[model samples]
Target: MNSAIESLTLDVPDTAAAQAFYDEAFGLGDRLRFTTTDAHSAGFRGFTLSIVVAQPANVHAFVDAAVTAGATVIKPVAKSLWGVGSTLQAPDGTIWKVATTAKKDTAPPSRTVEEIILLLGAADVTASKAFYVDRGIPVAKSFGRSYVQFETGPASIGLGLYRHASLAKDAGVAASGSGSHRLVVNGALGTAVDPDGFAWAPAEVRAGA
Candidate 1:
């Protein structure tokens, strides 16, 4: 029952342009360019990113399950290059490829975190904490209702439950919405976003890694 962030993907308007932007900017993973007739593509590991354009299915179910509370349907599920899937609009307005599992798991994330640390907002922290604890991802640490850490994943991942206001406060910015990005890598470096919107970058790792 360790529901870790095995992988993450997204849907973009210009696949080539976006992919190139990521490559030049972050320098995370290699280029895994493929086309999905219904607007689908993925960018593998990069400087600070690991997710791609191939996500697990159940786009609606995901939203229903509250995995994505403010998430919207950017593109409904339908046929594509590999099979069935959809382009979803994350709460942050970021598009994701909610593709069917039939699509091969292309970009496996880095083992850096070993466990995924998900920080939920203050309001949802309590109940969400119970949900993961019950599901079996060990809740290892807690800082009042502000934060709760869960032991999860093949990598050392720990999901946190917290509030955006607090996170923004730490970041020295006005409170805005948020979203999750799936990251993949070979050896070493693991990445995660802190209470602040800024990413807690993973340490450098090897590629053949």
Candidate 2:
């Protein structure tokens, strides 16, 4: 009974605005959904949603669309030893990262996203890793106590954990925040909060997802 993520529900002040921005920026379709909420969240929300693409061209396309659609640039697109990527903050205060390991264009440019990853910033990576493992989520990849990726299936949203401050730094944000996480992960893990305060709910089936 391994657990897997189905979809992510974001709590925003205005669902209409979020829907518009998401549609224009990433066109994520049903992989992401939204709900209206006035929950008080400030600074980093202890997590980031990442769009992993096929190449640098796609990375630029998504980041450009996000910026044009009113997302604030947290980290401009740049190349590193690992890959090229950028970080942005959506109008709803959610952090997003667009990245790819292929630094050069392999084929015609397209905005097709390869995967959606939800990375939780855990205070104790090892402990948080154990918590999810106890819930029947198998580890896909791990780097000692620094990071852990779970086997959430190819169709489901990817899940991972990283050191709290390191995750914030990767997203180009300060590691200080309070109030609700403003995110709910719908998955087979049932309803519960992780060690880093990420909430989870029962998975719900949606058309075309």
Candidate 3:
């Protein structure tokens, strides 16, 4: 059996507002879902949802839409040794990163997201990597104790593990946070919480699946 993250359910205080913002910003379609909750969450959620695009133009397009939809700019769009990217916090307090490795635009600017990655900030990357591997997810890439990327197959969203503090630094936020993660990962890994307190529920069969 192949293991993968089927989808992510974000707990927001207002589902309607979240729906509107997501639609206007990235047009994620069914790639992400939201539920209503009055959960007390503060500071960084110990995770980030990254929208990987094809080029800088595509990155700018999504960031502009997100800003127009009321997202707070956490990090201004700029060129880095790795790529061109920007960071923002959603109205509901979820952190997001829009990035791409291609510095130049090959095609016209559009909101074209190549991949959606869920990066979890773990206190111990090696331990967390072992936990996932034991659950049947294979490792796609590993950088010692700093980072780990799992092979979640082509049909599912990408998953990765990074040092907690480093993850927060990359997102341009402080590492201190409390309360619920306000996020639930649905996958074949069964119902369980990882060492970092990320909740995972059984995968649900969606319409297209």
Candidate 4:
């Protein structure tokens, strides 16, 4: 079964505010599925959304737009050992990492952000990896106790696991209690919770979707 992520649904106190922030900031205004609810309290603290780009120029553009749209910049855009990137918190308190595989170039290629990668902070990477693998999602890359990148089916977004505390610090957010995460994944795992409290649900697919 080829299950892909359809949307990253967010349940915020004010759906309009959160939706507007993303739309105005990253053109992702339409990508999110917003629901006003207290089922999962405000100030979500578990997962992160990674916005990948093909060019450094696009990374810079994205970070800049995020800041302009009221996102708190945690790490400024700069050359990192991994690549060119920046980390910030959105108005709704969700952490976002704008990055590209390309290194720092005097003139990075031009592009825009369109991709979304979901990173789940696992209390135990090994256990989390085992959970998903057992559920049929294949691992694209693994770093033993450190990390695991899952390879979802066609049209699905990227999924990865990082040590909870470490990832929270990296994204500059609190690694606290988890309930209804206000996050969703369209996958074969169906509606369930991983070992670390993250939830996954089936995505609705339309004609040709």
Q: What is the alpha-carbon lDDT of model 4 when measured against the actual structure?
A: 0.77
All candidates' TM-scores? 0.39, 0.95, 0.96, 0.87
Off by over 4 Å in 1: 1-3, 11-13, 30-118, 156-158, 176-209
What is the Cα root-mean-square deviation between model 3 and the actual structure?
1.4
Question: What lDDT score belongs to each candidate, Candidate 1 first?
Answer: 0.39, 0.91, 0.92, 0.77
Scored against the true structure, residue 112 in model 3 reaches a CA lDDT of 74
What RMSD does each model have against the real structure? Answer: 18.0, 1.8, 1.4, 2.4
Residue-by-residue lDDT tens digits, candidate 4, 1-209 = 47456667776668878877887677864357777666745444678899998878888888877788789998888887788888998876678899988785556555466567898888889999999889888899999898899887666667899998888888876666555667666556679888877777777657797
Give the Cα error of residue 46 in candidate 2, in Å. Answer: 0.4
Displacement of the residue 95 alpha carbon in candidate 1, Å:
14
Ordering by lDDT:
3, 2, 4, 1
Least well predicted 10-residue stretch by lDDT in candidate 3: 1-10
Instruction: Give the per-residue Cα lDDT of candidate 3 at 45.
Output: 87
Q: What's the CA RMSD of model 1 in angstroms?
A: 18.0
- Give one digit per residue, the lDDT tens place, for model 2 in 1-209: 33398789999988999999999999988778899777788888899999999999999899989999999999999999999999999999999999999989989889998999999999999999999999889999999999999998768899999999999998988999998999999998889988878889988866796
Q: Residue 175's C-alpha lDDT in candidate 3?
A: 96
Q: What is the lDDT of residue 103 in candidate 3?
A: 85
Q: Give the residue spans of candidate 4 off by over 4 A.
A: 40-44, 105-111, 177-180
